[model samples]
Target: MVEQLSRREGDCFLLTPNRSMSWKGNIRIWLAAFILSMLISTGMLLVGAWPVLPFAGLELTALAAGFYYTSRKCQKREVLTFSQELIRLEKGLTHKEKEWELPRQYTRVWQDVPRHPWTPPKLHLQFRGEEISLAPFLNIDDTEELVAILEKKGLRVEKRRRPEKLWF
Candidate 1:
């Protein structure tokens, strides 16, 4: 998820990951799904199909595991702030966070594309031989959009080479 927090005259760019669903909503949905599954499992048990009860329990476990993993991933986020004087990148969740700051004049934006077509490109900020990756989860289109935003913010954007096409 990508969102433009604010776009003002002085404020160059503010990029933040979009949170589509709230944690409360996720909990509600998970509870509803769990209850429905339990109801189905009870019906199967009443019908003399004892084997279905164990399978249903396994299904519930899998569903709970899936929800747990998804919620954890959703908690991670990246925030990029670019202004005239400073360029900042903040990543990770609340408990564990990493931040980097560089002068806007010396920072250069570029995309590192993989040789394989299947792999997604990564947006990077390079300054004085140090490189920091910006948006690793974004797709090709979102990466391009971010580059455009950076360019608009007066940062030097290195043009990426077009990938070679393979014909079967």
Candidate 2:
């Protein structure tokens, strides 16, 4: 479950990426590999084929590693705080915080970019001749929601349309 919760003071938005057990995503891939590995392992055991045991074990290990990495990388939490002059974002695993002071009358834009279902949405920040990224672990809808919240705080969003038929 992914959610954007506001702080008690309403000065910030806390984005938390909750643990998801829904096998709708990469779990399917891992399960398939695990099943295949189990089948091979069983076949090897039944036929007295000891060499195949290592191969099956290695395949199962690979699948477990993949699942662990994917789950960890997908989890995230970000806190977007707004002040009268600047917007601060605390993001990443370390929750390393960064701040961007708004200009006196700046243009805010939301660019419509193409995104894959498995990939997280990217936040592009431009201020004081510097470009930084915030909320690098959010999905597209969450990105758009954050953008809208920022717009209410008086920032411009520039968006580019995503082309149709993304797959080549």
Output the number of the TM-score-best candidate.
Answer: 1
lDDT of 1 by residue, 1-168 (tens): 567666552453434445567778878887898888889888888898879878878887888787777777767677777666888787886543888888988888887766777776787889899988887877666777887788778887775765677976
Could you give candidate 2's per-residue lDDT for residues 20-56 as a string of tens digits?
6543566787778778878878888899987888888
Clashing pairs in model 1, backbone N/Cα/C closer than 3 A? none
What are the candidates' C-alpha RMSDs? 4.5, 5.3
Candidate 2 stretches with Cα past 4 Å from truth are 1-10, 16-19, 22-43, 94-112, 115-122, 160-168
What lDDT does model 1 reach?
0.75
TM-score, every prediction: 0.74, 0.66
